[model samples]
Target: MRLRVDLLPHGQYPDVVLVIDVLRATTTAVTYLERGADALLLTATPEVALALRGGEDGSPYLLGGERGGLPIPGFDFGNSPVEATGQNFTGRTVVMNTTNGTGAAHTAAQTGKHIFLAALTNAHAAARRARATATEEIAIVCAGTDGQVGLEDVYAAGVLAEYLLAMGEFTVDDGARIALTVRRNSGNPLEALSSSGHGQHLGRLGLGEDVRFAAGLSTSTLVPALTLDGDPPEGTLRFTAG
Candidate 1:
């Protein structure tokens, strides 16, 4: 029950990789999936995502991503969870690229082990699942903004660490402790996020409301786990049965 938390660089390790992107890739993915999007395809590069959309055999995928906190030109949607929450993506696959979230996914995948997509939305369920896996260690990957620690992402990771702690069996690491401490220290979590690097960037683009939405804790119970092909799995919660 050893646990370690690391920023994107820890991606090379052989541990359960939990990718967190609070503002707001992972958050948006979980919202879309829970609200009925069929699947989400995480891509490292915008070119790869765009190429997949144009490929003849590709599924009808909507291109979603952001660069510098604004929607990439030619993308169908911005990387805002609020924007994604409204659609009934029942059978459509969302192809996404992001400043941090998606890149962490690819990096973590390099470990060649199981990976899970996490955010405050699915914190509890995800931690429970990780504990059940019987792995000696788990690495919670925080997708900070531009390789620098971002409050929202670290806060989300802390939420997961707290959840795992509540389970009462796993050993926590210093990184995990830092996550929990930071999350608790943000006396006014949403307010604290309004000043983060990503938050400020989104603010400049008139996306302040989205920052508030993404900062919420436990808004949904769905856990959007990554599958072998980088697409979200069929079920909303990976550990749940049909």
Candidate 2:
């Protein structure tokens, strides 16, 4: 097996891809699935998500996501894992659009045979799923903050890599090595997240609890995998518990 990490969402990926956005997006996704959300529809922009007001049959869809780490004005929920934990979505579908994470998922879907959303909340499960599904290669793609690399996402990638390396005989690239190094040097998930640029930014916005919630390592065993509702661009990317 071969393993590599993409610090940003660009370039071709391998057979199995794990997308990480530890600051909030991917973390919120895991929380939503764990909390009983039926399905999550990911859109690259708020406009697209908003356009999806309901299913084909007209059942209402809940809107969720953020821009600049703050709640989008018209969104029903911000990209907050903590807030998601307080709601029950047993029979509802959610449309999500964020600053980074959803776009990363769309990019990976273009190449990856299998794509899974990864975060500290489901690091172990995501790694295990990749190990079980990957036949030859695995790419860990980080959804950086505003197009720049996010340290929190890298740290989460390292956490996933640590688990993957232990489960197989995989050769890793420099990116994977860098993630591993970051994981080794970081104190803990919360500490790493709390000190990150995005984390601090969230703190100033009074969302510190979200940072703490996202720092929960292996708290959830659920792994959300991407599935297409139609085709690319016009099609929707939906995440469900895999």
Reference-based lDDT, each prediction:
0.75, 0.89
How far residue 154's Cα lies from its native spot in candidate 2, in Å, is: 0.7
Candidate 2 local Cα displacement, residue 212, angstroms:
0.4
Name the lDDT value of residue 121 in candidate 1: 63
Q: Name model 2 segments beyond 4 Å from true.
A: 54-58, 229-233
- Structural similarity to truth (TM-score) of each candidate: 0.88, 0.95
The predictions' CA RMSDs to the true structure, in order, are 3.9, 2.1
lDDT of 2 at 137: 92
Instruction: State in Å the error of residue 77, model 2.
Output: 0.5
Q: Poorest 10 consecutive residues of model 2 by lDDT? A: 227-236
